[model samples]
Target: MSVFPSPPSSPPSDRRRYAIVGLGSRRELYQDGIEKVHHRWSALVAVCDSNPGRIELARRRSTQNGAPVPLGYLAADFARMLRECRPEVVIVTTSDASHHGYLVQAMEAGCDVITEKPMTTGAAPCRQILDTCRRTGRRCRVAFNYRYSPPRSQVKDLLMSGEIGDVLSVDFHWLLNTHHGADYFRRWHSHKRNSGGLLVHKSTHHFDLVNWWLGAVPVSVAATGKREFYTPAMARRMGLSGPHERCLTCPEKNRCGFHLDLAASPDLKSLYLDHEAHDGYWRDRCVFRADIDIEDTLNALVTYNTGATLSYSLNAFNAWEGYTVAFNGTKGRIEHSVVESNYVNGREAVQGGVAPGGVKIRVVPLRSAGFDVEPWSAEGDHGGGDRLMLEDIFLPEPAPDKYLRAADERAGACSVLVGIAANRSLESGARVQVADLVGDLPVPAYAPAGARGESVPMPERAR
Candidate 1:
């Protein structure tokens, strides 16, 4: 790794000081925004992680990107970073369960917080973070970058305009192919205590999008989840005998389809492999580990406060990625489907179906004919929502967003509560209510249907 100049004395008056807590691959998404696109508006004041190699690597990458090298802080010195770096905003990109600690600390220290999705793992942490945000009166922005994706944004606009009339219900199903989904089993996410399972960790994105799209909060949820696939028996059925803790030393490395050669790629090596001394975290654990607690298959039935019901399902070991969602409304039904590329999370290129032809959004009117809606597409990962979301986050003077795209603690809490409820339902085998998890949670602000009042109403033309 390349060593570079020291940290700058102080941020300019035009910029906001930022300290990122996690130095994993997800850190790059935010670092790129600060270095290349938002230089004028944001500065990387400090970077913190448990691993020393990642800290140095972040500094090297920042040097390469023409950004000022930030001060490095170990995970133990997170409070010291707040005291010395005095960052105006603390970005929590840590593991799922650890987010609440950083969020609470930052808010209590009179700093705003921006966190990766799922917010925190369980209901207790979620309550604590919510209380901290309210008590400290600081903002906590959850990065649900999917909300800004062009095709999804179009769906939001269509719903806001009541194009499909009042959304009565939804049927949403998301699939994660073997490559991408299996990667979770290889990392810290395999344990329910670490990630609160995929329903909370991954589905937070999907649940949040649904809540925002419908302009409502989830009220009740009944769910079921199990580990049907990715079991030891399945691995043995593939003619792979014996048990291995991780793939790095597995005898079936050549034969196993799920082997991840972390040492082969320099980036992966430097990011994870070379830094095992400090954390002892293995990034290439066996996908079929017997101790893995997270469910590979999950189904949920949710009712929103706005009288909208959703039947949702998630399957990890699927043939392809992406999703199919349909909104049933009074006037008509709008359906959206996508096909996405599958790969290990931080490996090759960006994730999701950003390509032009892979996504389709259609409208079927109740009375007239149906028509295909050409989606508003953008380039980059997660259907190009990351860049747009970054613009909103990093820009000093962002344009007035009527979509209410910038999410606060309420949005953060409401998003995770659905999954939290679902997780409870999975355990109890009964319907779980969101309010029962977090009592009297405030509603997220959404624009009224009159947002498109200036536009003329369209009637179907004679075919």
Candidate 2:
């Protein structure tokens, strides 16, 4: 069966021109959005990638979407692609460390840009993106799709409505189950240099949620991290002799529960396994390799500019995937949790989709009874945030969003800086101030609310 649904017969001529660099699995959302969903408003003009196989795959996908085959370019020819294609906007779905280069180059070429999260891996590249965006006056948007999820958006609305009054602190814990979490160890993400460990690569999502939910910038971070689960010792403990190079050649593939067969899925085979000679990028390396430097367990304390402190933790090898967050406010408390289904990336499955009846929200008032608040529901990936976010990104005139979920480079810096600070703290064992990393970063615009020092209604005496 074809992966993409049949697209519109003919797209309009006035559609915005878009080119996407980095033909990874993450690029599918934008590519399909341009060709299938918002074809009337957006046209994909070019695709670029380091691997020629993936570039061809993207062109094939365009044919599947019933759209014109976009021009394909190798990574080395990116500048030439920009000059030739003249894309109005460049969508960057590159690796965490390479995002800044593509973003800056695109902006310099007089094109706006949209990037997948973490924006960049380190502080230096982040500053470069910010400086270039400011100098060129080109819009640089960070695709923080988590903020657009219906249930998550509802949380912002509740906070804005001052239902729990001024938030004083936040407690957030995120869990990545073995199925999805283990996948990270099998890819380039296992290296700190490429991904800045899970703190910047994975925790960026959690930290950004706190920043957006509180409507404040993080000021400082103190953290500790360790690799306990996905380690060489764990391989022996699981009765494997030791870690091998890749899963395809691993001798204990039958014994190792974490073994991933790229050939089992057609998408993975075509996208990665079949193209091994082009870039030699393995889709299924052993999880218990000794060279893996990223941590599996992480904990951090973040202080916000609003004087709200956040206690956050991320465990990558949990039994289930999801998160639980609580807001401590001057008047009351709000708690939200969701259990997400497990799915490996690149496969034909929803990434971060909520399980059946997995969302729960509750409010507890001081000296009063607590009640369960119904969650806002949605369908599709990431609790339907991807769909809504695509509309906002590709649509010429999307509706005014009161939540202000559309994030820019400023918001991207605010979120990743927290994780970057945490990484430094892990190495130094001292609190790292965000200002020290990136001085005087402008705060992202947020919806106005009465919570920041406004007077709260006095509660009645307890019964």
Candidate 3:
């Protein structure tokens, strides 16, 4: 481990100051944006993490931008950072459980907030954060990066133009192969309390995209979830014996490629292995243990505020990553997908696919309609929305795609609200209403059949 830098102030900047919390996998994504985008729009003023080394690592990484590194503060406490650093923006990159805590504090301190997904584990905390933002009159943005991808954006544009007509319903399915999905089982995400299960944590992205595309709000949801695969008993049934320190040390190490070698990667080692002194939790563990509450597979039926319907499913133990989504509209239909041959490890993804990486789009016109599917444009990753979304977030001035591309807090909340409802539905074995979760956050415009492509004005309460 390298010696961490101490708090040092950079020259004054006109841009807003920001701080980061939770130095984990998601932190890296924000860091990517900070290095690439924050230079102009914002400045990383401070970083906070429970672990000393990660806090140190984040501080150093924030400063050393490969040029004249800007100096910033380092603190283990977010509250202290707020008082000392006085950042205008608070980036909550912490674990799922800690999201609401930092979010409330930041908003109450009169700072804008941008946090990673699931909003908060459940509606209880989500309500608190929402209330805080409302009372304090500060903005809260959820990082649903998937919505900004291009191919998906095209689908969004198609729906908005009524080219696909009124989006009556949607069918969405995603498969996370063993290489990709199993990674969740290895980390803190295995617990529902920590990651809000995949439905809230991961599906929040999928749900948000669908809401944006349909231009409607989720009204009600009924769901079911299960952990049919990856358990200690399953491992035992597979004839694996106990007490192995790690996968690489296991007798069946050769047979299990899903095994995580925690010590091999410097990033993993510095983040988890080296921090055992501060926290005893082990990062590498079998996914099937009894304490792992999150589901491996889940299914849901959703109804939108405009009465649009959606059937959704997600599976985590497939052979590859990516997802498939089909939108059924009154006039036409659009389907999109991106399937990987294998997982990308180190620098290279094991080769196996005919199509390009990321989601692809196919729009089909109804009989007597003008559009053609064969001549349609193709998109890459999240349907080519990633780069475009980055541009929307990072660019100093809005571009043509920016207005069509960005999703506001209401859009973000409405999307995750469905997952929050679904999680409740799964728990109660009954239908859960979206309003019960998010209390009627405003939604985007909706068009009835044959209506012109005009923005359906939102009511004051809806807004």
Candidate 4:
């Protein structure tokens, strides 16, 4: 492992300095973008994380054989990265609960920030981050790469083209197969306190799609959720009399279908299995642990300011991983279904993208015969969204986007509030108002329901 750089030291030659916090599985998306894809224009100045082992692992993975290793810091010295390494932008890929702190402090320390989605865990932290952005005048960009996915971008284009007329309602159901879905239960994400459950952690991407597809802000959300699968009882029912704390030591390792061999994948092996001593963060905890607090199934009804609504559901343990979304509009209905290959995150190069030949889009015009609409196809990682987002963030000569895929703090807050409200509704068994959670937020400039690009405000709720 590379030694931590001394304070007040200069970073690699003349290039934009970026410091990344959190060396978990998701860190590769941004780290590789800076080091491999856009290394010339951007320099990875420093990496900080609570886990020394993960930090060392990231250092090895991100640095080329002959390249000067980027600096490393313990999480406590994050401020040192700002003052000493002097990063122009801070990239936060930390645990869900810690994002707001890093985001707010980085901005206050005179740096722009880029963060993974959901922005913050809940409404309190969301409001703080928003207020910090307003006070510091620093940009906080949330990575919502789904908007840039080719087939999804095409869906947005079709909706904006107005052939579907004004959107009135949306039906979206996302499924996560056992392979990918069970992994969530193994990590910090299994608890609501750490990840805000899947509603905030996983569904942020889905809810953002709905908000952007309709070009509206969510006003009210009523939801119901439960953990029907991934239970200790289910494991016993399957005849696994003995289940270990994790897959690595389980007595039923060979017999259990959900067992994850951390040693099999070089990436997962180096990144997680070899580093368990640093933080005791097991990479393969049993999916049916009784301590798991988040729901495995969720259903929500969301109303938007544009009078558009969403009927959304998420099933964590399913036969396959993907989503089917249908938009109902004044003119017609647009439906899209995608099947995605599911793998344990960080265990493989392709995390979650469109499975080969897994995309289908259909259009049904009102008072007209419905026909299949062939849309633009995608190739590459993350359905070609990650590459585009990387270029938009790092490259100086990227194409201007009409879909407005780049998301700001406002958009990030708007998306997570839906899930946050859903979590609340799940507990109270009543509809929860989004505005009641975070006060009113400015509506994002989303592409209009028609081809016209106009900014529309979600209707003001009577407080």
Candidate 5:
């Protein structure tokens, strides 16, 4: 008889600790995971933000939710926080400009990193992040939570099983509806410098999904876009002479529903009003202004390493926040979508958009004579992917076999590499390749203190 080793007597408490940077809208990710999924193995040990009041607000919110109120810290700068907190992981939800600075520092400080989508703003920073990860041997995960949705995962499974045959080409169209789309124009993200344009900031998830589904990498991209609808010039032409910004304080604030009443939402209030004592940035602004550089609408053609082609379009001024995509394979086709709810336009806007229904999937087997449409069960937020991703991120079981959704540096790089290339293409009016955009950049040996760039708010109106 084979002798079996005795099981370890003690239970596992080897949970990894995390420190969150940038206490903004995304910080709820930490709180939700703590309450629902990762409660066992991980805890948010620290929270950092340039604004002390935001930090305090987060502590208060976490406490009310029964989580260990994390130790709050001011920016103290990212480098100092990494050294002081000594966490195993860092979650970066900072401003777009500050993403690279914090990511590089955390990796160099010997911590894994989980950053919000659109990993870094541009080619230079993207390369810097890739290089640092290459050097530091730390892992990096971009929160492209959509990948975990059961329907999308099922689509991937079908592709792998050759049920959808070899994917030939992909056609994707995403809409943001008025409530969700207009919100982009109202805040700091209105400017390109702050949010890297919606193409990079918002579509990173869409582009990354294409990369994942095709099992390929983007080779080249070319795009064109315009901000025709949401501009002050157009507003004036339409017979309205409102201020360049949203008329929140205008006597007609009630008439124009896009008004961003800063006091309406608690998060908005605590973050913008109370926190303004620390930093002077404003969260609410006009959607139509002269200074916006990002496009409200964009279209791009992408060629992948596997020679698959993808056509993409993004519009921010729609009536909802979701996407619908179809994959055409040599044998069959598969499509998926999630209709998002109305954005928190203001505190009093009680309207909510229930998910349209379910992910509608169809498959045409190579030998099939007809197409079969299947409706997947409806899921929670983010097409039901958010909760699953949190489980994999915050909790893991020890075993000879384990299910993992962890992404490393290369995966992280692949997701945003196309967006970076697209941004370059946007400016040069030329087709740009991912390799060329990041070529010859130095990856830092260790996380540095800050970035060497200027901060500009997203344009209030797309151009």
Candidate 6:
């Protein structure tokens, strides 16, 4: 890895100095947030990555953003970067399993941290993060942009307002169509050690949303997972001879539907294809490779501390993308669904972009007609949640949010532990308690919701 010299000294401004680790595509959100959107209050001081090419690319991006080029460092020199850059905050966008190390070290070094979701892959790292936060007395924020999506936040508001009464149970199903879902099997996420499967890496967004919406803690989970869709058998069924090492060198690329021509997209080529020699990390691995360990289909039954149960399923091979969720409450039911446009990561397309007229919401009161709700709308990626969340993160003092959308380590653990327990359950063929996975995981702070046993008007003798 090529290391750049120390950044030149300059007169300090009131803007918060920031350093970022891991220069993958996900880091661009925060990078642009600091340089372009919130430049008045935030500044990027340093960028680090395992691959030198990405580090150079990040610096070039800084120049392109009309910001001063930050110093660049290899992963081994992270501590050096922190010491030299003296950033007030460290933003971590590393691979899922590598998040905990950077988070812990950044906090111990007296810098606040903002990490991309899933926090860490497994229970042990989760415990380490919680313990490190407690011991160091530093802030660790998990960027859960899903919570900031207007329609989703509207759901939170309705629940807190007792629109659906105290929720008795929940049914949520998330679908990932071939385009976006298959991308997971193409990258490092294909291995459980790297991503903890979609159950954690992808569903962390969904799980955190549920935990936040209901104001509850997950207590136990029973789950089953399998990889039936993206496998050698499926590859054969599709008339391919068998899975090849990767799409770049595959002999059957012309016949395979899953082929990803990284060189075709300028963004993918610059971000991953051109940087291959540095790490030997293939950006277009075969989805049906036999070495893939993670599951493509998953189901889990979760029980919450609030006495509510959740029946959730995630399927990677679906006709459409997005999710349908319903909250079954004592007085009524709230049904919410969204259809997202399918797009692979690192491409020019919006990640998790909502389809036109994609959002739907309905509330059915007991013994009464159900009415449709005009879904709240926003104007950016991930249903505009990304822009709103960036404002929350980079702004010095964001407006006080009633939804309590800002999440710390507690909320992070709550979301990750569910997936962790589910993984354990998948192995043991039995229920796994969240507490058993990690103790002292306090319930996350949530906006007030309808409490159980609260007085409820009797439904007018259901006709």
Q: What is the C-alpha RMSD of each candidate to the true structure, in Å?
A: 3.4, 3.5, 6.1, 5.0, 11.5, 1.4
TM-score for each prediction?
0.94, 0.96, 0.85, 0.94, 0.85, 0.98
Candidate 4 off by > 4 Å:
1-3, 6-13, 447-463
lDDT of 3 by residue, 174-212 (tens): 888887687677667888878888998889888887776
Give the count of colliding residue pairs in each prediction.
0, 0, 12, 0, 16, 0
Tens-digit per-residue lDDT, 1-463, candidate 1: 2222365555576689999999998999999999888888799989998887889999898888888788888888888889988899999888998999999998999999999998998788888988888798898999999999888889999888878887889999999999898998998999988898999999999999898998887889999999978899889888889447888899889999989999997768889998998789889999998999999999999997778899999999999888999999877899999888766767778677554478999999877878999988888888789999999998888889877888877888888988989999988999998888889787777623333223334656666
Error of 6 at 182 (Å): 0.3
Lowest lDDT 10-residue stretch of candidate 4: 447-456
Q: Judging by lDDT against the true structure, name the best candidate.
A: 6
Alpha carbon deviation, residue 370, candidate 1 (Å): 1.0
lDDT of predicted model 1: 0.87
Residue 345, model 3: Cα distance from true site in angstroms: 9.4
> What ranking of all candidate models by TM-score puts the best one first?
6, 2, 1, 4, 3, 5
Candidate 1's C-alpha runs over 4 A off are 1-10, 447-463
lDDT of 5: 0.70
The TM-score obtained by model 5 is 0.85
Residue-level lDDT tens digits of model 4 in 18-69: 9899998788888888878887878888889999888877778655522446
Off by over 4 Å in 5: 1-14, 35-37, 345-358, 366-369, 398-405, 439-463
* Per-residue lDDT over 14-127 for candidate 5, one digit per residue giving the tens place of the 0 to 100 score: 657788888887777676676446656776767888877777777777666666666667776557666655788999988776788889988988999998877887777887
Question: Which should have the higher lDDT, number 3 or number 4?
Answer: 4
User: lDDT (CA) for every model shown?
Assistant: 0.87, 0.90, 0.69, 0.86, 0.70, 0.92
| lDDT for model 4 | 0.86
lDDT of 4 at 397: 69
Alpha-carbon shift of residue 320 in model 3 (angstroms): 2.5
